[model samples]
Target chain A: MSGILHIAGLGPGDDALVTPEVTEALAQATDVIGYIPYVARVAPRDGLTLHPSDNRVELDRATHALQLAQAGARVVVVSSGDPGVFAMASAVFEAVEREPAFESVDIRVLPGITAMLAAAARLGAPLGHDFCAINLSDNLKPWAMVEHRLRMAARADFAMAFYNPRSKSRPHQFAEALDILRAECGPDRLITFARAVTTPEEAFNTVTLGEATPEMADMRTVVIVGNSATRRVGRYVYTPRSAV
Target chain B: MSGILHIAGLGPGDDALVTPEVTEALAQATDVIGYIPYVARVAPRDGLTLHPSDNRVELDRATHALQLAQAGARVVVVSSGDPGVFAMASAVFEAVEREPAFESVDIRVLPGITAMLAAAARLGAPLGHDFCAINLSDNLKPWAMVEHRLRMAARADFAMAFYNPRSKSRPHQFAEALDILRAECGPDRLITFARAVTTPEEAFNTVTLGEATPEMADMRTVVIVGNSATRRVGRYVYTPRSAV
Candidate 1:
């Protein structure tokens, strides 16, 4: 039996944000597979098999799901935020490519509100016009690539939201990134430091890249750096293309 | 009875993207109001009133809604994308500012996906990390400020999305913006041109910014120029800082 793979997007920690389709898929899935933290977000449902694993082994989990699907299990591969946005969707595709028999497999990717958009919304739409998203983790790609993007983004003057800016092992990366940005842009570009946005523990801050050092962020943080068009109107940050 | 004010975010054209809450609110609203096109999207329910006007006359509509609310009629302020992003929410706030008596009125902003996020999702995670959105419409703001932002975003090398890039009369503005960006960044930067994204008529072309001329984009387009880190892997455009 060829099992259909449904990659579900669990919107930024809010059950209300989950679409009816995603909810229905979760309710019907024989096996729910995801990273441990993401798996914990789903409440218990009867007859559902939960396959949770650590974050370190992503491909392994995808392979396991494919194997289970090949065994005729109705499987749902879940990811926090959109599954296609740097998540399980890629892994599933990679695994599918490795096995030709999976060619006939029906794969559906249901989109979700990514953290960048969620953070941008909470921060008053600094992302209202042009923007880009860059992960600061240098685990897979070289930091050189990250720096190059940073330089290009700075030169391009796009409003930016950074994910995985800082982690335990790489504590000072955000600071370094800020330094590069400040040099390329200027000191006064409005920047927002948003953590756990839309979640109950959501916290937000406004600063300049000049003020944003590594000490101010972590893995939980999504940094928003405004373009030169961004301005400080009272306490709020807005990028006005038209004068009010 | 003080009439309720409904501020609706019509998600990026996909009817399925409309949340259950939005549908319920739209159904319940006695008077539906918005820019002409947005008002046309939701079909008239039984006993519903429709108020459609030009896109730029937001404050006027908000004022009208307030007057209707004062007259004990429920009114909705509808926008094609999220109400907050360069849309009706601010106008509602502005109208409230004009008539402080309406300050205590009940207001609800239903969240919908914005065009930027929808476009980014279609373009393959160019928005997965950090980014900015900027409008090229300069009716309210001077070209100097817009130029400043364009220069700054280029310098910062952030992923950038441009909105309201051009119209019939203002044909050359986006081209001028492109010229500015080209001079600041290089011709080799990856650019994704998305028009009518997520809609049935969605059209898209992804190429290097060097390849994108102003004629290729218009007011209907949402343009994304990738940071140096952005790469096209197969059909996907992704910028990664790590593998996992």
Candidate 2:
């Protein structure tokens, strides 16, 4: 029996934002794996198995998907955003690297609307120019490296989108990150905090770095900091294509 | 008469990658405006007027869309990828800033699978970690700024994605960019070229910096350069979630 694995992104929270490709993939899938909330997004159906796990067990979950696929079960490892962007695709690939047995299993990644892009869309193209996406969580990387990246991105004058900006595990680091950004980019830089974008609870707040507070961001919020050229026109914020 | 404007993404060239949000917006549109190829992607109907324009005229196209909307035409401005990413969203907002009459047009940008994310999905998550997206076309920005961004992105150790990596107007600049990248990122760095992603002419190639050539990329290609921790697993390439 032959089986294939698809690392698919369901896109932010809205079903409307999810792609037809992912919808099709979900339709054909015999097994779906993801975090608890993401797994809940899929309707329960016959002949399908849903394996929902905790967030931090990405490696174990990836290994499980690979194992299921190796056992001739069609598997889909679902992620909320684009799977390749700090999501399940890397974990699955890393799992393949660690276990030689999973190497031969067929795997493909399907992209979706990542959180930053969804947030950017809501915030009126704050990332319209050259930009960087950084995950602010220190779970996998060091805080110092995060600080270094923040400084370099600011110095380069690139618009920035930050994911996983603040969480219960490390609330204070976001405060430090805000301080670093303020020091590097100055008080006049525009920063936007978008929480639960596209969902019922969606909210957006744009302010200068001087007015931005660490309390504005949480795990659900995606933060975007504009470059020197970015500004507001009426209610919209955007960065011009040309450099300042 | 109430009119709304949705600057929407078509998601590369594949219909399957297009989001339902954009699809619904198109269904409700009285006028659809975009570049020639992107506008062609929308299906024509009795009530909808398709307005396709040539390249290098983003501002004019944007202004037209706003004018249509201001005249009580529900308009959707289509872009190949996420409209917020180096596409029509910024142009529309800039138009609003230039003309006060266009400012009150209710505008929404719908996100899609951007080329870099789509390319990363095909290449097995090379942008799995923190990454930056840079448009290499010098039509809108200075070459010096592009070069500076490349160096800063390299120094920050961020994985990089280049859109419009090469064009007939600036064929030689990509070669210069490759040289700068080689100098900053070293010859052993991994680079992947993905052409017309998610479309019929889709092609993928991965090579090291030492082996890469400027001729490898074109206007149709999205190029991704992995960070230090990126490597190949079996036939797939991926960047580990953990930093090196």
Using lDDT, give the best candidate's number: 2
Which segments of candidate 2 are over 4 A away from where they belong? Answer: none
Return the top candidate by DockQ: 2
TM-score of each: 0.76, 0.99
**Candidates 1 onward: DockQ, in order:** 0.28, 0.90
Q: Where does the lowest 10-residue lDDT sum fall in candidate 2 chain A?
A: A235-244
Please, what are the lDDT tens digits per residue for candidate 2 over residues B1-244? 7688999999988899999988899989999998999988889999999999999899999999999898899999999989999899999998999999887789999898899999898889899999999999988889999999999999999999999999988889999999999999899999999999989999999999999999999889999999999999998999999996
Worst 10 residues of 1 chain B by lDDT: B235-244
Model 1 off-target regions past 4 Å? Answer: A1-6, A24-31, A43-49, A59-76, A83-108, A119-195, A200-244, B1-6, B66-74, B94-108, B144-148, B178-189, B208-215, B241-244
**Chain A TM-score per candidate?**
0.94, 0.99
